[model samples]
Target chain A: MDFSQTAERISLKFSQKGQSVDTKKIEAKLRRLIEEFGVQPAEAERSVTNELAKEFNLPGIGTGGGGAGKPGERENRSIADVTPGEWVTIEGKVVAILSPVSPSIAQSGIIADTTGAIRFVVWAKANAPEMRQDAWYRIESAVIDEFKGVANLKIHSGTSVKPIVEDRALIPSILKVGELKPGIGSVRVKVVQEWETTHERMLQSGIVGDESGTVKFVIWKEPGKERLKVGAVYTIFYALVDEFNARLSLNLSTATYMQDEGDITVSGGDSNVRGAVVHIAPGSGLIKRCPVEGCNRALSRQNYCPVHEIQPGFVYDLRIKGWLDDGEKTYNILLQREVVESLTGINLNAAKELAENNPLGMDEVFLRMRDTILGRYIICRGREIDNRLLVRTCERVKMDTGEHTALLNRAGGAP
Target chain B: MSNGGTPAQGRKEGGFEREPARRVFAGELRECRHQFREGDDEKSPTFVLLPTGERSNRVFLVGTLTEKQRKGEQNIFYRGRVVDPTGTFFVMAGSYQPEAMQQLAKIETPAFVGVVGKPNLYQTPDGAYLVSVRVESVTIVDRETRDLWMLDTARATLDRIDAMAQGLTPDAARVKEHYPALDPAMFRKMVYEALAQIKI
Candidate 1:
């Protein structure tokens, strides 16, 4: 057959097997195989068709295992050894059970054996037995299939799933950093870093760890309230692991909490930052705050704080939302009332007077503050919360004329 | 149970760690309208998922300051138009945005500038969305900086395109699911053509 006829036949076979293959990809792969191997056209066609059939687990194709076993009752294969189009009886524990949400699909989740883990799928029409999580089940006549390059088991009506009690000790616990998945996970580690706070909200973020290593963590309470002191050992429960720029950060919500296991020094993690003030964001000017003690909430347009709710005694406050670029990474730096006042030398009283004088005068004050701070290199000491630097203290980096000239040159300009 | 490993910093619940700004053309930014929150919680970070599959909260762009105007009779804010080879970006800095507004006020039009800011989306009366930048910081840079930003942004855009090709990111998969007809090669060509505009 010609190439187009061969492609047509392969597409037809895949459709009959209830699988959708990228016809273009198959045609390209077939062309590459023919060109590279220099095999006869008819032989290449048969090989491509057979391979695609096996990948989709269609019946009547050879198991391709090359093992001497019975036609239907084959010896158990390891999780990794289970190939597409092969049927085998395997004993393994279901690691996780995922509820299939689509109307067309049924149940699916991850199942692992001694060798490795693979996803298992049972179609809605298959009417297969339920696979309980963390329980060992001996699955007979389960066909292996490939989905997106990963080998998976397809439990059809022909498959039999029998529960077998196994020792729970064989299951893994307390995921290491390497074993961390993007779902509920627990880690036991010393508090390597204590609470870092952002002034915009009473939020805390820091690092937690054990020898398998540490990961970033964020809790939505003040450090004092969370009692997350540095160098303390705690078992952090129910952390939602999230990937930021390929690095994992744990989010501790109401469902998540930590148990203190006393003091233990965790070496090597600190967040002392210094960088040039590259940008100052809006909300960096005169602002009103919630009157309630310890509630430094920025009032909404309705003049209400979520916690305090339209109190008559709201006070004026100062804050700055700025960016600091330290050559490598840019940090969102938030300076609270005191830091803003000290850095710009604009007290709250002066800010109020400026606002009272003219409607647009407060804009001018913020403009002046921006002029004073932007582009200047400064050292900042604080903890990071919510991916922003919560500055406790800061000072400008004094640049000599020579240093100034060097900076200007690097910026591609002359002084 | 605590497992030990290297210590990494944590990010806040509602806030995301600020992503590095991506240099992009006006056309690409204008075309991006889909915005979604990453998590269901109140603190979940919202991101503007681009057609090229990049999820960004902040973008770094360098362009020519083509025009400037004062908007809002009651509020009195500054709006500047910055353009690259593809299109223009409207950067708005109000009284609240003191630094960006002052920089826009002092700088002359038709001069090169670098702006780092958050992407702001507004829906108009005609049911179409308008894209603009809430300027965080705007600086009057030279032509060289403009060229460097273009190259960097093009490289970043290409990275996203490559990711789509490899099917490595969920954003890429979502792009395919949402915009089935989008030709990724078109974005790749757009980046290369954008890079070609630079003399060096």
Candidate 2:
């Protein structure tokens, strides 16, 4: 599990329980818990999670086995065994106390057992006891409903909420490659390779592998931070997965944390190809950028940059993304501003002039430019970056103008 | 899928990929009956199948601008009709399409023009769909450019046919699925017919 993501989720859980806890402070505490106190990362996570819940008087989440109940009073159930339309007595720790879905709702969030986690909702009008984060709960007479295919518990006037204590740890299950999805997940992997940054916000990217297989990962970290050393094993916490053509790549953010778990070797390589330009993706024309120093972020919707905040000083830029096909296979290629301007003969200033003269005309000009080279052949050099060729060098293969002219003349022309 | 098989993540919202503007005939554009969605994401691409069975998000064609008109009382919009050898293609430009709209406003009718644009498939409540080109670019080109476009489009269409025969492209699979009646031979005939229309 990406620890940073776990920390973030934990902090969010505490905040939703109406606790005043600083996220940065939590992150710092988590780091110290693992490094100084020598607590296992998962155990450290539980401690911080439990400690905050105690201070805020929040329900225990991820704490195992709770609530007082009599035998045969209600059908006992585990989280993973839940199905639609089942009314059963379930016991689990409150992993997260989510914000009420609406103002009229009292409390709702995820409750987890060793089997799995499911969402629970206690409607406000029920006037049920409030649940706290990380607190164990044994609720009786809760009904199950399938919402969008996921089973969740519904607590109402007939339901009873009880806070009970248990002493088992809530550890994020180590996931495999096939188990990865487009959401938060944690994985243990060997750093097979690491690449230098080529794109913004992507501090470092390369390959990571485990027993199942390998996947690409891009670490989003502050510049100059210590990167995960190649040839080492690390437990990544709170990582986000993004899929491309069925392939997955992991994204690391600030809320995530990593722990070095010694060293292991892994292997992989890159492939290269060349082809003709087939398509030009949209956003191929004039665009604006944030003008802050070292922060040329794309400005959209109110002209804002997340990092530098809102700075109206904008700059013009150009880019083109398209495919290159050499008959057999096709490769996605990216042409940055310089290459685009060089190929299209349309510079930022020229595009700006066109935009000024005819704002919507820019799209037409863009398509016209795409036509000029779409069928032409070209040679581009770059390795694959998420199934796309990050073209480091590009040169157009000049077309045989003589033969094309002859063919056009013979095809049909006005007398 | 509408965008052939372009990956979903790479073409996120706000990003654009120029679909290989298939060289579709005006008649085929009008006769196209099915639309395929590549991805279900909010920004996923939607493509229409020409009568010849090739999928197109964008199209490149050369034609004669037969007429131009500005419509709308509160908002001025530019709409034109371009006639190819086989049939007529309706092209529309509005505030959102300022560039094409302005160009249409300036162009004289009966002039040879080249257009590259997204295929706009409009479906009525009655289940009838109208196919048109959302103008991306409109340029007044000479007859030579028209002939060149014809030959290029013919070659590209032939390539698509060959790819389909070999079962090499994802588009070929979609064509086979949605347009089972279409064959390379039929598309080949259309390409030849289009080329024959170009008088030297």
Q: What are the per-model C-alpha RMSD values against the true structure?
A: 15.8, 15.3
Supply DockQ values for each candidate: 0.06, 0.16
Window of ten residues with lowest summed lDDT in model 1 chain B: B1-10
* Per-candidate TM-score, chain A: 0.51, 0.48
lDDT of 2 by residue, B126-158 (tens): 998788788876777667656655665555555
For each candidate in the order shown, give its overall lDDT on alpha carbons. Answer: 0.66, 0.66
Error of 1 at B52 (Å): 30
Highest-DockQ candidate: 2
Q: Interface RMSD values for the candidates, listed in order?
A: 10.7, 7.8
Per-residue CA lDDT of model 2 for A196-228, tens digit only, reads 356656666777877566788886655434467
Candidate 2 off by > 4 Å: A1-76, A176-288, A291-296, A300-317, A320-415, B1-21, B25-58, B62-97, B104-114, B117-134, B139-152, B155-200
lDDT of 1 by residue, A99-215 (tens): 586855678776667765566788776676777877998887676765544466888665667899877554324566556755446666776654324543546567776655567
